[model samples]
Target: MASNFSRQEPWNLSQENLQEWFQDNVEEGSRSFAVESNKSMDDLVRFLHNMPDMKTKGPKAKPVKVKEVRKGGSIEKGTFYKDGSDLDCVVVLNGIPKLKANTKTGKYRRGHLKPLVEKVVTALQQASFTARCEKVSNLQLKVYAKQETGGILEIDILFTGNNLDYNYIDDEVTMQRILSTPYNTMLNMPPKSQRFIYQPCLTPLQTEFVKSQPGNVKSLIRLVKYWKAEYLHQRQTEKLINSYTLELITIYVYEEEMGSPDRFDLGEGFKRVLSLLAYKLGGFQHYWDNFYSDETAQRGMKLKDMMKRPILLDPADPSDNVLQRWKKGLGTISEIARETLQTPLLRSIHVN
Candidate 1:
């Protein structure tokens, strides 16, 4: 039977459709700053203000505010359904540093960042919860945990020191500088795309994963754009948006296998991110249930040891279900997903 998919309101990629997508999803009782983020901007602000290092006006101290950027953009939702879903959020910053590049290394390295994050980690510790802060993405520390109020929050505390020179009141100058910053400088990926990369956002990591396989980024981008649009169209419940995003990342990261020693040789912490995101998300089951390709499931459970999870997938035809269809048609989807799935886990999932 031919697919009976109908391109509807939230699933359309046209501007009109995007407006509606934003209206239906974002404008109508949206808790964006809440859902997309694990933590609160306000909490982040307060924590920083209390930082012992930033408390005084000395040779190396600066203050920052919650830099909120609430705007609209589209999401990858695909087929008859591309996507038009937009997003809005407050991009808050803790402390903006005032570091001028040294004559040698240009931008200061770890030596400059340690003091800043250490103070950040210390203040976050006082939150009356079990929180830990560690350097993860570039200059950002992945700090997170559950608080006393039973709220789960994760944050990317960045030590940009990018725009801390409060001496200027000129918006144009500041905006210009902010724009010129390096791509990897402080979870840097916004100000343009309709889709936010950090959250439901397609990332460089995902882009890299896709590079090795079938469909081009445009096609894959379209698929993800529609996933959020259509999924939101169906369910607008709590955290559904975030869930969709995580699923998007999961799908994008799916790969074949990860036993290769070359895994560590990938660009810029690619190996670590592959392992961390996979395990943190949901282990093998995360990819299996959410992003699993029929091939993985069909890796031959009939082999006794391997075939334990036979491929219920229509071996002859892979493109069936939308998600499944993507998996089969676009080999890259599974390739990335497998790399993410087969990460070296501290504890491999068991099926007893």
Candidate 2:
């Protein structure tokens, strides 16, 4: 969807006018794209479920058992963008023990899951799907399946032990352990392997946090995401902010500005989000006690020294500081946000 603001045109639009434009453009576009994307996702999930058990070869080769496959990320949370949209599929494997960090070094052996990843990719190709695997980072291994409809489905196949269950959030001990860990170790070997190994288990909580918001709040999220996409376009070298971080920031802006009101000015919230990004991002710190207690967060912050600037902790997994990797690009992001805030459409809106 196209933004209403332009660089050259200075339009003196009211808050109501901005909201109307957002509804007509941003909200409507998101709904239309979601409808089409959901259908494709349903088909993809069905295909994944029906596939036979895949096997890997080595000295200890065995049939890779499938426990369940989950849908996560924007498509699941309903904050998906039309351009460059993709699904996050977490394939949970049974009988595969979670990899443990070396006690001596306190770091996991890198590429431990390479054998399993290769096996999954082979299975996808055998099923007539064009699949490619890439190790995006030491913590992330992803598989991209090219669709006949020209869209790609990004799958994160996780090998986890039986100990980490879906009800982990209910376990107080688990939550405390997750919260108290230092950021460096957490970044390397995330608690319960939430970011790398057992991320699928945390997907439900992450999805519910955003999905449970009001319609307008979700729309605000979509608006911010669209703005982020447009701003970051053609700037691949910059460490672009992830969609989850943007979603949380949007929610935080709305909650801070409008409280619990069911409805508010969408444009006003958008402007404040830009204002925060442009001016207040360097010292940003946001967390939610939806899954863990605030007391736990406070203690954890003190223990982990996580009170550092730009801490955007994952609500589902406290160990994950979502903004940790994007420190280098904050200046660029702040500059773009400032420019967007000064654009003709947003500049006229009074933020108080």
Candidate 3:
């Protein structure tokens, strides 16, 4: 593990040696993990992707059918960590009416997603995988399969209406509509529910937002993820910041410090990221304009009343403040970030 290098007087190493250390220790490990995990992960994705459309009864709505299964999360974005990696699958259902907004409050109706989730679970069980359902703001089905290496691979399935028709990547109008529709009307719902409801629909854009970054940027993201997993022990608790938030933060730091340079010092970039988290995370707030302009995003933020500390809006979906759910862990994360910045391995790496 790269953590072993920190104990061996890393601060004494020169800048060139520090870069080499990061390359050999961090980048190589991430590459090796991806190589070793690719085959099994690929097989699972193929299996799910090839599954036939399932016909199942909806509890109250008409009989729904599986419209499509889309890939999401780190697997789709290519920033998965070595220690803990899971697949995020979005199951799009047909025949279910689009989520209706309350005429009075304009908030989208809840409790309608569970039936679709239950059907997805039944389909997974029939396909020879152990499946279970749970509700955390939205409906999710966890499907388990045994890997060839004697480990279990867990895939989280989220159900949504057939809302993937729009080309959100290229169509700004579609992006605006999707983000502004339910989100602008419903500011009073819990943050988690607000984000989770439209997550499946926005998965493609989210994957594209991360996947379209430069290779080096993705490498930096992987490095940050490795650090989070091994040093911060973030995998031990769900309350900690998520990998997506970390990826966006890394991208933000890299872009701010290094700009569009062909090549930059990963060590310096990492130090800057740690510095931000360690010293300035208490009031961290950032968003991107990939799908919408900054002015539009600011309006949406105001509409949503996203005034909390450590706010990071999802680039694909401006309505989502990705870090809202992880507030409880911010103090611990800030403390760890501070300690990590002072570590011998990183203390020598400084940024302007």
Candidate 4:
């Protein structure tokens, strides 16, 4: 529940807006994984090892499987891409800061990991590795890669985070300050050089939200990335342009389809989410349970397609501006927490 979100518009990363967005966007469904084929994933793996951290024996972790997208009211269980579709590999990292590449003193980029994207492009230019750096977030970096000839290959290195710090507490027996022993690491640390990083914790509901692909997945993905981008620095995460669009999409879901609680975990993380959750907040259950059913979406949230509209860029007609244009988006209601018969109160969910 240690969340840092705002409610004011221009939609920066605010907890108030995040909550409402989830309610509006997420569909009631569950999601799991069934893999097939992917191209960029391989390159992403190679890219992971190429990072300075791995090169210098820093903490390198394995990539886990998440759910897929949705189809005609069904979860699409398959590889990330099929045929000659482009692919991209990724290495989701933790304990890294979203500080700009120039910030000279952070654990993740001590000038080593900092120049990675640039260096990769340089390497690719020489050795035929086609890649591009797309978006970078607080804890995640989405890099794009593709075949130069006729294919697609884009991998996103989602740098999920856990607090990695070098806090030194005192050892009573030793009568001296000692380093804290952290968990969930594949690398060993010395007392003087302990690592420190920030990790997020999501509720059962929230975790379901992450995997809820198209549903809160897309919206949550925006929250995850946008917050890091806008806030991790001097500003806030919500300030990003995409953040507002994401928030708008969220409101659309909740106001539209308030699905049952359990159904939220339906298909798998991605498929179920994409199919049911995103922009379909009509069916979220305020309570808890597992598994799902069509009956769930019956009593969904209040969602409506608001993004499709006409607009003009006139300052005189403030509504003509980009911000005002979204302000006109239907279902712009923003909420923080909700109350139900169970008196079940809600709190912000943050996970890495």
Candidate 5:
């Protein structure tokens, strides 16, 4: 394992106090937030499942199934930001009407995708917990709700089965197999296409990859996410950075710069990641072979916007650059990173 602490000045605190600070601030705070938010997520999941629009009435009718709220929102990742936390929930709609089969091609016409997503939106708007429906997309709907404790909760309900009739319930295995397929075979088109067509199908794989990461790495990720949230609050600017971008960078720092996730000083480890951001860490790209290949990642890398300074490849979907949207804000983020280093404790972060 390679370490990057050689040039940095050492902290004055002993190891015991550093560990105590992390536990009180990052770890305990994150767990507490998850506990409260999860109760609301459970209630909301039940409300959505019981909606008339979500019900199926026929011999083939089955109970509506809601996938677990995986990734950052889950307790495992502890990724709640200070001002607001985004919870991602994946739901599979059963007994949805299939598109009219094309007589000429004998393939299912997928024109019903939009209507189904709209249907979901309408149902959620009518649901009791939803304060307002914020945004609706082709595959997901974003809604806002006020927590009983006076916090704001933003939920993104992803209909995994709704993308152009590529229903997961119908053929999951075949769709998932494509994630591991060669990059060229998956997309034969020009490399400039930015659409992550296979994102929905690969959700499970993404969740699992994050879940299986070492515990220490997850802690480091949560700490960086907390810092980024504070960084934005101080500037009071538009939301330029996504939590996922920092999560990947944290992983890179731990794997490449900090030697190993198994052993490290928590405060020093965090400072190292912040230092990387302060310096605009770039040049090398990273990918995991858990779901894709190096050759495939190399090919998929062509689609990313090279003009962007730092490129962090999505672990599950190599063709997508998770950091692309945050490119313009790198300079500000670097400055913020420096400011965070001077503080002994990161503050004003709300978990709810």
Candidate 6:
């Protein structure tokens, strides 16, 4: 006998079918931004690559070497919502001066990293592009992309020091050691704290994780993100939740309820995710150690103490509890899901 789930056809909540709706609206959302952003990114990368370092000594002076340009955030994840206006890029600066060791903390001071990031903003402004340094807890250089119509695009340039120690290795032990190395560290300070410290680096692992997912899985993420946006707008709350947290939650649902991505359905995936949010959201914890070591996984389990509910460990950086501070907003999502599921038309699609 065939399994009922295997025989079920795709269902859509809207008047038009789900596939058609996605083809007409959701999938088409990122096209314009993708094209315009690509041109600006290329121009900026070229400028950054060719810019000379004035501080270099006379005879041996050479242009700065930008080792890598890694794309991050929703845009890179292929889940950017309709009318999304921001793009994130991480540029690794090679040959940065190491920070002096702090005698007090027995660790290196990260004050030097900020100045290095600021120099990026200076170069972009000098290149005659509309760029400026945004003052925040982290060093982010904001460049306004040239746009003929629609809202201006904001490109967030996150600077990270090059980690030559991070070689291409499959060994878990070797990888964990590299992640903990000083070369992979980036400056991170808690809000209203005088104490500045280095946080573990963010590589392209998260990007690749999402990118590796099948197209339907990516569509599932976009659905949750779009719903979250609508939920936040309806509530008019000041507290903002991380989009990455929602993405992980969606991934968890797809893996647990829907099985493999090969046969994943958009409507069914959306139902499982919304069901998780609606029903089992409180005290939820799901993780996998695909990218990190078992020891890192054990260490990450302790970080759950800080999280309220719906705990999720960031796949790349274990120290980050992606859903730590999303308590009230999550409740709103749960309530919204419950109410939406109660609708007569959506009930059959959402229910098991």
Q: Write the per-residue lDDT of candidate 1 for residues 1-352, one digit (tens) a residue.
A: 0011223433223322343444455444233433433234345545555444343234655554434322212221111121233321223244543322222222333334445555555666767543665655434566565544555555444444333222222243453343223212312222222111122111212222323333222233333434334442333322232322333342344343323233322211232333434343322322222222333333322223211211222211111111322222223333333443332221132211
Q: Tell me the lDDT of candidate 3.
A: 0.66
Tell me the spans in candidate 2 whose CA falls farther than 4 Å from its real position.
1-5, 8-16, 55-63, 84-86, 98-112, 126-163, 167-195, 234-237, 302-307
Error of 4 at 198 (Å): 3.6
What are the per-residue Cα lDDT tens digits for candidate 2 across 303-343?
34334678877787665677776777778888778767766
* Candidate 3 segments exceeding 4 Å error: 1-15, 35-61, 84-86, 103-112, 126-138, 168-195, 234-238
User: Residue 169 in model 2: shift from native, Å?
Assistant: 8.8
Cα lDDT of model 6 overall?
0.59
Ranking by TM-score: 3, 2, 6, 5, 1, 4
C-alpha RMSD (angstroms) for model 5: 8.2
The sequence of per-residue lDDT tens digits that candidate 6 reaches over residues 240-346 is 56677778888888777777758755666777787788899787876667666666655555643543446687777665667776775777667767765554324
The lDDT for every candidate, in the order shown, is 0.33, 0.63, 0.66, 0.29, 0.57, 0.59
| True lDDT of residue 49, candidate 6 | 68
Who is ahead in TM-score, 5 or 6?
A: 6
What is the C-alpha lDDT profile of model 4 across 25-48, one tens digit per residue?
A: 332211111122233344445544
Tell me the tens digit of each residue's lDDT in model 3 across 270-316.
77788888888777778887776676678657644455767788887
User: For candidate 4, which ten residues in a row score worst on lDDT?
Assistant: 336-345
Assess candidate 5 and give its lDDT.
Answer: 0.57
Best-to-worst lDDT order = 3, 2, 6, 5, 1, 4
Model 5 agreement with the true structure over 230-327: per-residue lDDT tens digits: 55444546776776667767777887777664777666777788778777456546666555666666766665343243567777666667777677
Residue 266 miss distance in model 2 (angstroms):
0.7
